[model samples]
Target: MRTAEEIRRVVRTAVEAAVWAPSVHNTQPWSFSITGDEVGIHADVDRRLQFQDPAGREMLISVGAAVFNLTLALATLGYDPLVHLLPDPDRPALLATVRLGGPVTPDEHTKMLHGQIERRRTHRGAFVDVMIPRNFADALSAEAQAEGVRLTPVRSESGKRVLAALTRAAQEVQAYDRAFSLEVLRWARPPGTTRGDGVPADAYPLRPDHTEPDFAQRDYSRDHLWGYDRLPSATRPSAPGLVAVMSTVGDTREEWLRAGEALQRVLLFASAHGVRAAFHTQALELYHLREFIRQEMLEGEYPQMIMRLGVTAEDAGTLRRPLSEVIEEDA
Candidate 1:
């Protein structure tokens, strides 16, 4: 059994790991509270994108990813995590409370995943041409299944093209909308920014690195000349990578949380193998477009995330809020 000091240290380490989980626009819209043996994960509603994520589904999903990281951290420390999701109906913001249970040795795979919590990054540009390992898609599907989510790779050329077209359409629509543009601007950090949250100016390429079939990226740079100026080798047009959609049977808040957990799990496993993911969630942000994809592509399952996975030569650094900003410890 662990003493109080050890448990406190574990909780602090877990929160530190949890903050590294990716969030939409790098919002990092979650907070942690420690009370005795339990750690609370709460959604910071103020950080939610009101225009883009009015329903707060994406916010819940982001927090759920943090939950996965926290639990994985605890497991790595040899403690079973008892996670209570949406524990109280009256307290919607309290997403989860995790209590340290009996101790057990973490498996090799769990250790591998836990090792990647801080290293995994959300890739934002085209991937190199090298093919991913064979049967890797199967492994990713299993990871999602373990979290009650489906990871479907768009294998057919036609399917990839269709999804790409929809993404482009949505990106164009959002870029032209004043409210959507403003929301994205609010989270797009300027160069040399001291703020820890938001998509950094250097995270994306200065000029759009267009892939074949061309899935449009969010205009984080907007009207300014912001973004990384990569070398010629990195600027060359590259493959769109393996396109996949994460989906669930239901579209409830619970399902969104599951999708987020599954997302982080898949991301960590992929990162462990030197793979990275670039997200194209524009289509999913639009109601009509999301419904269309759900009906036409996903066959009724709600698509929570659209992503392309492959190996990348570049590692664009990300920023996160310091532990002091997000953690609250009981007196």
Candidate 2:
């Protein structure tokens, strides 16, 4: 049992942790509302990427990741989070509602993940010449499975090449398309910016490091000078790292949310072991390309995220909106 003020404090802490979850272009498309002991997670539709993510799949996924973080924060604070996904019929934007109940000892694993909520960053360049252990890989897959998502590591050389080629093709097309380019540029921050809601210039290298298989990265810098000064070590072409795809059985809103939860959980698990992930999601944005991946690569499973995971010496920083900008009070 807990008092009203204690519950309010816990909810506040949870929202603070929730905003740190990664979003497409750091859109942070989520808002929180506290009503006594319950917390409501809402998707901020205005912040959604209209051109790139018209279906709101990515936006919902981002909200779901926040929900996962909120749950972990509650658990770290010694409470059981009772969750209801898409709870209200009249309010479709309401993604989830969490109510903390009962005090219990925080598990070691829960604490480990909670500790990494603010530390993990999305790696953009090549990874070090090291392989993630089999045990850790297995654990990551299991963690996704627990949330009804599948994390399949693309291990074969041919598979890697196919994914890389598709990524390159998508990147080329998106770069040349004016609308796509403008949309991406909108979220890419110039260097020395004070804005805390977009992908920062420091988040990626000035020049893209061409990995062996050459999975292309998003051109956040565009044409102007807007990235970190290249380090010889950081820019050296290296292994493509462990390529993986996150998939779900269905492509519904519910499945997308679950995929996001799985992704955040897996990311936290990998970060706990000093591993980081770089996303190559442009191909997944195209309908035909995504279907090809679903049929050829994922055995007909709907692909949600395509990523490469490995260890990195470079520690990049990410940005998030403050709670004041994202949270609302109940009227």
Candidate 3:
């Protein structure tokens, strides 16, 4: 094991990288507490969307993604991360506690993913015509399976259309509800604002290209006209390269965390292959829609994340609170 000071340094670095994990609407709904050589992950419930995510399930899943990022960071640094999910039941807010364990060498692929940890963003536009290599997709599916989750890629055009229509239904439901609209608007930042959290105006295109299935994106703008302008040079709206879902058998809290770990594994692997992912989780937010998808579509598996995968040349950025704001010291 590394010395206390060295462990502290590694933990700090890992938390720094873990902040890049995607959350619903860029809410960044998580915080970290550094206690000696270990770090405790907590859901920043203050950042949760009460109207849209009142149950805290999505918040937990997002924090689980952050935990996955922490493990990846530790692995790349040659320290096996020892993690305990939801360690204190009394303290429901505490998501996980991770610390340095035995030293283990990280492989080339892990290092590659670690490199893109910060640069990867949740894309909000259509993908170019480029095709995602099949081998990479298979490997990502394997990664998800390793975490007890299934990453199913929609193969048929009919399946793609069905998923797209479901997304449309969910988006329409969210759009008409004032409460849901307010929740989204709360996180969509206007241009020129320098907030360190929330979805930036430039995070997605102003006029997103409609793919064949016509997947609907979250209405972050809320019709107030707050977002980046579309570039004039852009011609056609690109295709939806890959439509996929992450699912598991159970709906327990632990399963949610596992789903999140699987999600990060898939996303980082996709990022390594230069593929960006756009999330259409509006369907998953509503209980009936989620239950319907699980029963009719997923064949008894619980849906965690619904996304479209593809390639893009965009240089979108992400933000997180400083360690000072998130990290709580034992003292």
Candidate 4:
């Protein structure tokens, strides 16, 4: 019920919100195209992490998160979003197309999530020793279920330790592998770099603090001490927090996209409650480790993301590509 120009403006604002969704290494591996009133989401294959994510699973997941943001943004603006996932047969890179439909009132919950889209960040180090509300896990699980994915909290002490040990082993193996190291270094920016994308040095601590069963972090500071020098209070060792796994019934590209949507929803909802998340995705990146988790830890669900969530005082800023770099408007 809107004019052409108004629809374009709505789509444009939606894309602005979409870009804020988190991506692996801040790769921002998705692009947007607006034709008429529809927004097209495409995966930028060139930006895919070839060595680390050869299957392009992570890339699809990133695009999916963007899709969720776009949907939420449009909904928050009172426009019903009609989504078509993987609509094109020959052009597989076209992940989704969202068409704006009838207007309605935005709900309080949708607005709450939309408000946190830009504020949400990926916590790279330890979190404060505080208990997350018991109801939070159930709420987050409901969010994922709505998107057709499962968010399982690793509750058992032994189970948490196993995931931590597997993460450690995977990190150690990847650290020594030249290809993996190079891939990580490629996306790791040194302090003051002009690149708008990639994980900046300041996003992590100069030295990682240990948890009881240590969860290995990705080495953004490979050789140089290129990280934030935190205050003593922030450097105190803390627990690994709540370990959780995001999984899907199948490992297809569509399922990966669903997992990404679930991930962003969980993240935004958690952020709304002042909770932060640190990823331990090393095991998910490795083939054998991922298979082991599927069979043993996840009860046959294909695990997509492994993360720990808790409260943190630190908010290391992240960067994203300018909208001009990622958006294409039809003439």
Candidate 5:
């Protein structure tokens, strides 16, 4: 059995690892507090994308991904995490409370995922010539199944093109909406910013490659001043990697959280196998477009995440606020 001190140490390390989970524009919208033997996970409503996610569904999903990472880290350390989802009905902000439990040796898969937590980044550009192995997609689909979510790979060229066009339509419409544009601009930081939250200017390419089907990227860099220099040799159009829709049967806060957990699981698994993902949540965020995707593309399942997974040489750097800023340690 591990001592209390050892448990605390593990909790701290897990939280550190959990920060690396991807968030929309790297918002890092969750906070934590370690109390004796348990860590409390809460949604930082102030960090919520007010205009984009007014209902807090996406924000909670981001928090849930952090929770999943925390659990995975604990498993790697040979302890089971006893989690209570939204335990307090009145305190809607508290997403979960995970306590360190008895030691249980982690499997090879757990350790592999733990190793990938900090190394994964959200890709924002074109993919290499190679096609993703279908076997890997099967492995990823199983990972999603473990969390009550579905991962459907859009491998057909026609399916891929339709999704891309929907993404483009959603991006164009949202860009013109005053409230939505402001929400995204709020998170796009200026270059050389010391702030540890939001998507830094260094997180994407200054010149985005227009992949086939021409899926558009988020205009976080509206003025074309954000992101790093385009890869010098990546001048030609390339494949858009593997397109996928992460969905849950029902669209509830709980289901959204499950979707996020599955999202990170799929991401980490892909990372371990040399793949990175670029999110095109544009369509999912638009009601009509999302409905079209659900009825046409997903066969009526609620689409929670839309992304293209593939290989990229570019390393995108992300950031999160220090634990002290968000954690209510006194609680």
Candidate 6:
């Protein structure tokens, strides 16, 4: 049995790891509270994107990813994380409560995933042309299946083009909408910004680098001279890479949470193999487009995340709020 101080130390370390989980637009829209051997993950509603994520599906998914990281940290530390999702109906903000159970030795795979908690990054631009092993997608699918989610790779050329075209259409519509544009602008950090809870300028290229079929990226640099200077190699048209959609059988708060957990699992597993992901969820934010994709592509499964996975040479930067801003200790 561990002492009280030891448990507290492990809990804190787990929270530290949890904060590194990716969130939409780097909102980091989650907070934590430690009480004894349990950690409570809460959705930080104030950080939710008002226009872009009005329903809070994305917010819950973001917090869910953080929950996965938290539990993974505990597991790596030889503690079984007894996770209870949506433990209280009365408190919707409390997404999960994880109780640390008896210590056990972690398996090699668990340790490998925990090793990538901080190193995994959300790639913003195109991936290199190197071919990802066909078996890798199967591995990632298994990862998602472990969390009760499906990872469907868009294999056909026509399918990829459709998804890309929908992404472009969504990006264009959102760019023209005053409310949506402002919401994106709010999260798109300027160059040399000290703020840590938004998409930093260094995370994307100054000018958009279009992929084949032209999947549109979020206008993080919208009308401003923000973002990193791309290398000459980065300027050329790059491969679209492997496109995949994460989906759930039903679209509910619980399913959203599962999807988020699955997403982090897949991402960490890929990151361990030196692969990265770039998200293009703009189409999912819109109601009609999302429904269309569900009917046409996903076959009734609710899409939770749309991303392109491959290897990238560019080192994209990321930022996170200090623990003091997001954690509460009641130990």
Where is the poorest 10-residue window by lDDT in model 4? 230-239
Over the stretch 1-331, how does candidate 5's per-residue lDDT look in tens digits? Answer: 6676786788888888778788887889888988877889888888888877777778877888998999999999888999888889999888889998888899999999989998988888888767889998888899999999999998899999899999898889989999999889888888888999888888888877789988899877888677888646755437798888899889988888888889999999999999999998888777888899889888799999988989887788787788777665543
lDDT per residue for candidate 6 within 1-331, as digits (tens), equals: 6899998999999999999999999999999999999999999999999989999999988998999999999999989999999999999999999999987799999999999999999888888787777799889999999999999988889999999999999999999999999998889888788997899988987777778977889888878888778667544538878899999999999999999999999999999999999999899999999999999998999999999998887778899999999999983
Which should have the higher lDDT, number 2 or number 6? Answer: 6
Q: Which of candidates 2 and 3 is the stronger one according to lDDT?
A: 2
Query: Clashes per prediction?
Result: 0, 0, 0, 0, 0, 0
lDDT of 2: 0.89
Give the least accurate 10-residue stretch of model 2, judged by summed lDDT: 228-237
The residue-by-residue lDDT of candidate 2 on 1-331, one tens digit each, is 5777787889999999999999999999999989988999999999898778999999988889999999999999998999999999899999999998888788899999999999999988888789877777789899999998999988789999999999999989888889999889899988778888889998887777778899999888878776666555544648778889999999999999999999999999899989999998899888999999999888889999999999877778778777899998665
**TM-score for all models, in order of appearance:** 0.98, 0.97, 0.95, 0.98, 0.96, 0.98
CA deviation > 4 Å runs, candidate 3: none
Candidate 4 Cα outliers beyond 4 Å, as residue runs: 233-235
Better of 2 and 4 by TM-score: 4
Writing each residue's lDDT as its tens digit, candidate 3 over 129-224 gives 888777777887898998889999887789888889989999998889999988888888888767778888878777656888799888666656
User: Weakest 10 consecutive residues, lDDT, candidate 3?
Assistant: 222-231
lDDT of 6: 0.91
Q: Cα RMSD to native, each candidate?
A: 1.0, 1.3, 1.5, 1.1, 1.5, 1.1
Per-residue CA lDDT of candidate 1, range 24-142, in tens?
Answer: 99999999999988999999999999989999999999999999999999999998999999999999999999999999899999999999998998888888897876599889999
State residue 131's C-alpha deviation in candidate 4, in Å: 1.5
